[model samples]
Target: MKKTLLTLCSVLCCAVLFAQVPATEKQALLDLYVDTQGDQWINTWDLNEAVADWHGVTVENDHVVSISLLFNNLNGKLPASLGNLSKLRILELSFNKLNGEIPAQLGQLSNLEVLALNANGLSGTIPETLGALSKLKQLHMSSNKLTGTVPASLGNLTAVEVFNVFDNDLKGSLPAELASNNNLRELMIAENDFVNTEIFSVVLLSNSGSGLNLKSPSLSPQAKTIIAIESPEDGN
Candidate 1:
């Protein structure tokens, strides 16, 4: 009886220790699983299993760093608790059926580099808090039902190289500060309702082929002349 009791105590102690590393992170994953219909997942995670063994989850030194579950058939609104993954670097949930507004709390991920939540049914405005991800390199949330103007705060992503938010219902003028990001390579904001666009530097679009198409901006005669001079020639 004493031997059995000792074994049970050891098991409980190990479970407690496992739960201690970033309690919020562990609970956040559990909440995400429950909210996103884990039972319907193509390769469902066994909640009883260790964190490292959970499918699509990448843990390093007991810290969740990446969650790449692209096209895994996730079909629900993302839980806000997901922002608690402080060490998260890449969060790719594209090609799913996720809907609803993106959690503003995602700004808390100071270490995030790539955030690809494109090709979903998500709607609502891009959260201003996303600008806080100073380390962010790529931000792709295209082919969605999102509306509202592109937040000017996004210009703060100085390290961003690819920023694609195409085929949406966004309106308003493009922020001029976006050109300040010298690292920017591709900026696809087509098929929207933009009435004005801040003329970007020639260097920014030197390699930007036919994909860059903005509506005729409401500008002065001088501005129009400048645009003609800087515009890349057709079929160039």
Candidate 2:
């Protein structure tokens, strides 16, 4: 009788601890799992288990808040349903084999802070809608096949600190509005084909002491001079 009572108490405790997220949030996660080929992931989730027990998932107040699956061999494209996780803050899926253009719906994640999707096979332009992430801080999309110019709308990310887009095929002038963002710290926009590079000297100069990696051959001599003046250690 004591053994049965103890088992029941344990079950009740586990139930409370693994309280599920809302149906929509749960479904969104499920969509990601399916779209990303979860079966092939380095750390796969067991759907039969509680949402809180899922690998790389963090839940709070019955809402999915964060998902960090970096270098997890996540194959396939990111599901658009991910935007449904309204309370989600961090979405890190770097160094994966995932392909396809980033879904614009991700911009709907208003509460998002860190958006790391680097070192993948992703292509296409960075979505203009991403500028809507008012709370965003770290935006990493480096080492991919992304093209097109950096969206001017991204300058709206006043809370952004580290904006990295290195090792892509992006061109055009760096958005002037980015210069106005006082919170920006690290700006890595190298290994691309951006024109009118001299205009971004201010942006590059500001992040000189930070982890600024602007060594593109396309940079004008004037920009190089600014880099040398601001970050003498780089010896541009």
**Model 2 C-alpha lDDT per residue in residues 1-236, reported as the tens digit of each score:** 99999999999998788788999899998998898889998899999999989999998888899998988898888888888999999998888998999999999999999898888999999999999999999888878999999999998999987777877889887777775677876666767777655555343433234543445445554444333122211311
Q: Which candidate comes out best when scored by TM-score? A: 2
TM-score for each candidate, following the candidate numbering:
0.78, 0.82
Candidate that scores best on lDDT: 2
> Which 10 consecutive positions of candidate 2 have the poorest summed lDDT?
227-236
Model 2 gets an lDDT of 0.80
lDDT of 1: 0.76
At residue 188, what lDDT does model 2 achieve? 67
Alpha-carbon lDDT, every model: 0.76, 0.80
